[model samples]
Target: MPLPLPPLFAAWRQSLRAGYAWKSLRGDLSAGLTVGIIAIPLAMALAIAVGVAPQHGLYTVLVAAPLIALCGGSRFNVSGPTAAFVVILLPITQQFGLGGLLLCTLMAGLILIALGLLRAGRLIEFIPYPVTLGFTAGIGIVIATLQLKDLFGLSLAAQPHNYVEQLSLLLHSLPSLQVGDSLVAVVCLAVLVLWPRWVPRVPGHLAALAVGAGLALLLERAGLPVATLGERFSYHLDGIEYPGIPPFLPSLAWPWQLSGADGQPLQLSFELIRQLLAPAFAIAMLGAIESLLCAVVADGMTGSKHDPNGELIGQGIGNLVAPFFGGITATAAIARSAANVRAGACSPLAAIIHAGVVLIAILYLAPLFSYLPMAALAALLLIVAWNMSEARHVQHTLRIAPRSDVLVLLTCLILTVLFDMVLAVGVGLLLAAGLFIKRMSDLTDTAALPKHFHHALSDLPEHVLVYAIRGPLFFGAAEKALSVLRRLSPGVQVVIVDISAVPLLDMTALAALANVLRDYRAQGVGLVLSGPTAQVRLQLRRAGIQRVDGQLAYVRDLPQARVKALRWAGGSKT
Candidate 1:
């Protein structure tokens, strides 16, 4: 047989083959601009949330967005810096600085590409819904909590690492809250919450930021202090210092050349890569899960199927190339993709155009963005955190889901908040697996033939008995399912085991059956395997179980096996 073709750039090819229409182009254009406007504030906010300059987030949009759009498997997937990474990235940025974070992103890109090549994308579907909800809810709490320092304008001497520490620090800093910043945050958050219902056509992020910036400006005129992006972050070019983001595109440079935690260039070596591997895996895992989940959502909205492996490869390529251009980690943003669908995007071109919009903003609107109040960005992220939490769904699941599922969910949530995502996911999966084994083991059974069957076997010997085995026989269930055979009556001279209903037989089950056969033989009893499926018969033969001299027998039907058993038991056969 010929080898199957690789799943690469399938989205682009399929979109073009569907025949582009002018109406489609118009929809794409509108959707692109609308989502792009939404993305500008979001990209910057997410980067700031990760403890980096806002320009790094814009660079992610400029590089990764177009690359993923052109090569991805979902036509409407919008890729950029996302809020989910805030929990994972912030710690990395604090300990290793921007350089380490970029290196970790690069490593994650390679891992994603490997996963695609290995065709492991379908495995992502097996992750339970409760687990995803748990971690996401936990992350939302973390992100919202992180925003508090800006939201309340609290001054912190140092940032803490864990959620509890961060919360404690925030509470302690409550005395230092700036009234002007708090006022701006409240106004922006209120607009963000109310504007979606008031003017659904306009993006809330844009309106909220505009109003918040205006409020901060008025406060500044009143001789009150409110932190703005320009005052907090700055860029340098041609030996001249400039406040806010630079009005230019990201240029190619090694990630290790960026500033480390000690304010020096990073030393790239095997030890550094090894130290970063764990976080890199975490980033790649989260990225793959988020991006694929986003694609599934897009598919549901548009009634289109996506090539998951192709999507992974696209995301890998985007991340692999983006780091050199000063971009941080990125993935498909669910909110932005949903907005794309609602705005009538029909192909990947809409996402690419969104990248162009970000590029334009970076070159021309950088200075204006510098004037945006940090409090306004905090408000935007607060809304994101609330939405990401999916509070109603969580509550519903807790109320209606199985107790074990609820346990898993809560465990994951607590672990994520107290420790980290990697540990939470690992423990949750193990717990889920153990519970699944118990459930499946309970489903498998070996039961005696019903009393009604005895009516048709009137001539059968009293020394013969029949039992049926059902369900898959694996390690978790094999011994329990076969325990009934071990309790056979002493007077029973022959036994028939019906395994036609069994669908699978693993080694553990085969071993158990072998032990049962050995015990039955020592008791001078005849064993008849009745109506075993072909596959089960193959397993019996491979395990050295076959017809012997009046000791063992295999029959194609249950009636034939009964007749044989009767003869062996010296009973009158029908």
Candidate 2:
């Protein structure tokens, strides 16, 4: 039977049992705390980047991290808001508002759970590498562009719905950029970029936040026109509030309320849900890709395996539950997982603890976040966008990949930027598959050759012939093999087929060979196959071709095959 759990999970279990050392517990605890510290600032930044209040991002980490750790199969896998989802979710939030976005996330979670239970996790590995690279590069570009507003503090009449229009608006607003925001962003970017080199071990993002917030406070006291988090956002109890869950979960209808422009209940439509389907699919695809990629990376660092399906199920459940509490889409975070592993995380417990830390921050420290400068968050994400781009990999793919593969990479990249991720991946995969089939077909060849006995001019020879077969006979080569045999010289007596060179034959090839043999027999040519490989012999035998006497032969070598062909040719004359 196939392995019960996914390979990643199986590996994880093996690692846990094999490498369980007491010394590692302290390291795990230390690492978990370190990762939690780094995640706090990032979680807030990511939530804002997605156009939601910073608290929602914290909520995602708080809700998702524990759920995934408890139910997931990876020991060090950390689940929370990620940069990749920002591009996919932002548009959904813009179009559908928080409710529709939450509903989409909920649907995506259910889809993931279904996929996990169906054992479809391994299928994620089959996603083309070029597709991943392309979409990721595109997402990085989108994220960087999205941060421009805060990065420069541009004042615009409205945010553009599309990337191009956004850029156009940003360029037009360059003169109106807030000097205070610009200075804060520049300083924050500098700190994030340089602090790691100096501090070496301290959480760089935390340092950037401290420095940026301090600078903003000092600037405001100095009478500078800086925009604080408080200036940008206000916690209006009436704006967007988390709904209270009853003691028992209420029915969908009881809780299904859509907000109107005037704060009254508005009628909901099925069309709104239908429009969200594409974006939801995009979220699910990206979540699956990023989470699995993070798991694979963690496996490499920890020398442990993760359960991809279980992880998917966990992610789905987390995402499904998170939006109800004002959370956006969430996934495995590569940076946080690396930090957790590097800090010596011992088990999934560390991730659970990390979630607890985030919860504590949310419950107590949320008000202090109002002092955070928007530019600092933008600077943080700018660094994130740069790291996420994987420019080195993109350059490498372009330089080293084959022309066809490069074409696929470029196609996906352009489509992801010009249209959306769904179109890019769908088209890129189809094109790549088509190109792969064409390449395979080009490598296959088939031809017909005369039997060895037919070369001899004999007195008793009236009609005699032999044919040779070679090469891998698979689906790509089957048609050529059969077509060549059909055009063989007519008026032949005995036909011996040389199969000494055939290394493999699939069912399609076998069927093609059988059909050609049947056609040859109809023309009165006695058919025989000689020198079949051990595998080929077994296949022919199992296919009942061995039972067809005088129609097939499995010889030990070419000499025996030649002798049999001579006797058959002589018999035809007699």
Candidate 3:
């Protein structure tokens, strides 16, 4: 089918046409403000975690939230840079620089848009459940590892891209930890952990960040070592200085205009495009999977069915356009989406209002937010990573799951932490698929020929034999079915294969069947195939397997097959 534009968002349209009352408007406004407040610190934290400026995170939120609200399928879903992308985005950023990262994001956006339009959005479900859990948990561990340096103020000579190497570097720099910075982190982490229990009025994360910032400022005034965003960002990112905020609104800019950390100009060429293709594809798949998963969670909470394809288009467009303003890959954040629902959001209007809140903060409160300590942000991300890891779930899975499933889950986890996410996901999916195939083939069974159904061949000698094939005749099960036929008795004169229970036959299975027929013909035994389905019969006919040399014939049923086999044995069908 040809690709089509995603259908209009009827949910949003309906809300406008219906009598949306002020009661609902108040709920949406309150929800929007609540989501926006929590999002401010998270957006900053996630951006830093991804090794980018805090503004980039806010920029993504500011642009993507509104775009998604206007075009998204889910009313409550909040889309932006999420914790899940931190590991995946880092490698691309290091290899390609900011320009290449943005370009890669744009390409990913285009790919996602194409997938949504093609209605291939449903393919995300095919990713095995274990694979999703493994990689997600693996990512959580990686996120926690990445934050340790900031959490303890352990500045390494360079941050290694590989997890093992990074861990080693972190270990070596352990002696370099500053107590002042550690205390700041402790304050923030404690606030985040205890605030919910003690004081539920203000968002715990925000309160934690504020306390951490105050302590850092006091440490700075007392001449103690404490790193702040102001100290860190003023000299970061290929000479683009930042102390507070850019103070400039987002505007159109070519991604290739930026340079690498080493000052190498990023040239947009076929070679660069080729280099980023794999990363771009990773971004697209991850974004689509995350967004849809968030939408599903929102649906469960709100009893609303979101248009998956429409939401995909909204996500795609957001990622595609946000890059032009120096934003990274954007997608629906599950935690934030869930929060939007819990905050009493009634419609997409809440998301739009949330975006407006972020825009206002960026314009007015950027300087104040810049006072937030990196240590606090690190603590916040550590908490997020802990939640995302789902360690309890993973532990439970490792215990109760089948050995093969455990193997797959562990393989994906090990690969993600020990290597690149691209390799991890690719190998995880392949391993899961192989395991599925093995299980399918195991279910395929063959049984002895039934005598009651062989009454039509009563006149035949007792040496005549029958065999029944069960389950799908796809590649996975074909060899098992053929193995059974190989064990036939030596005195067999006619072989009747009952395929009445078989529903499918691919080329490989057809070839296997042809091989069985050839072996039987060589041994001077007649072969009869019973009950080829319409689709299977079409394939067999196309393969020229119809009655040939009085040995092979496609019969309607077991009785017909018996009669055909007897006739073939008498050399009548020839």
What TM-scores do the predictions have?
0.97, 0.84, 0.93
lDDT of 3 by residue, 1-574 (tens): 9655565574486456545789889978988898899888888888888777778888888887788778877788888889999888887777777777788889999998888788876888899888989999999999999999999999798869788899899999999998889999998988989998997756898889888988998998888788888777753336766686665577788878877555687877899899889889999999998999998999899888888788888888888888888787889988888888888888888888888888889878877876778889899999999999999999999999999889989999999899967888999999999999999888788887556665664555566677778888888889887878877777778877778788888888989888888887788877778887888888889998986675565767766776666665664442
**What C-alpha lDDT does candidate 1 achieve relative to the native structure?**
0.90
Scored against the true structure, residue 479 in model 1 reaches a CA lDDT of: 99
TM-score of the candidate numbered 2?
0.84
The parts of candidate 1 lying over 4 Å away from their true place are: 1-3, 454-456, 548-550
Report how far off residue 142 is in candidate 3 (Å): 0.8
The TM-score measured for candidate 1 stands at 0.97
Worst 10 residues of 3 by lDDT: 565-574
lDDT of 2 at 98: 62
Q: Candidates' lDDT values, in order? A: 0.90, 0.76, 0.83
Candidate 3 at residue 499, lDDT?
83
Q: List the residue pairs that clash in candidate 1.
A: none
Q: Residue by residue across 1-574, what tens digits does model 1's lDDT show? A: 9866668888878788777899999999999999999999999999999989999999999999999888778898999999999888998999889999999999999999888888989999999888899999888888889899999889998879988888888889999999999999999999999999999999999999999999999999998899999999999999999999999998899998888888899999899899899999999999999999999999999998888988998899899999999999989999999999999999999999999999999989999998999999999999999999888988999999999999889988899889998899899889889999999998899888854676645556678888888889999999999998889786989888888888888999989988888888788788887878889888888988786555665787888887778878888774
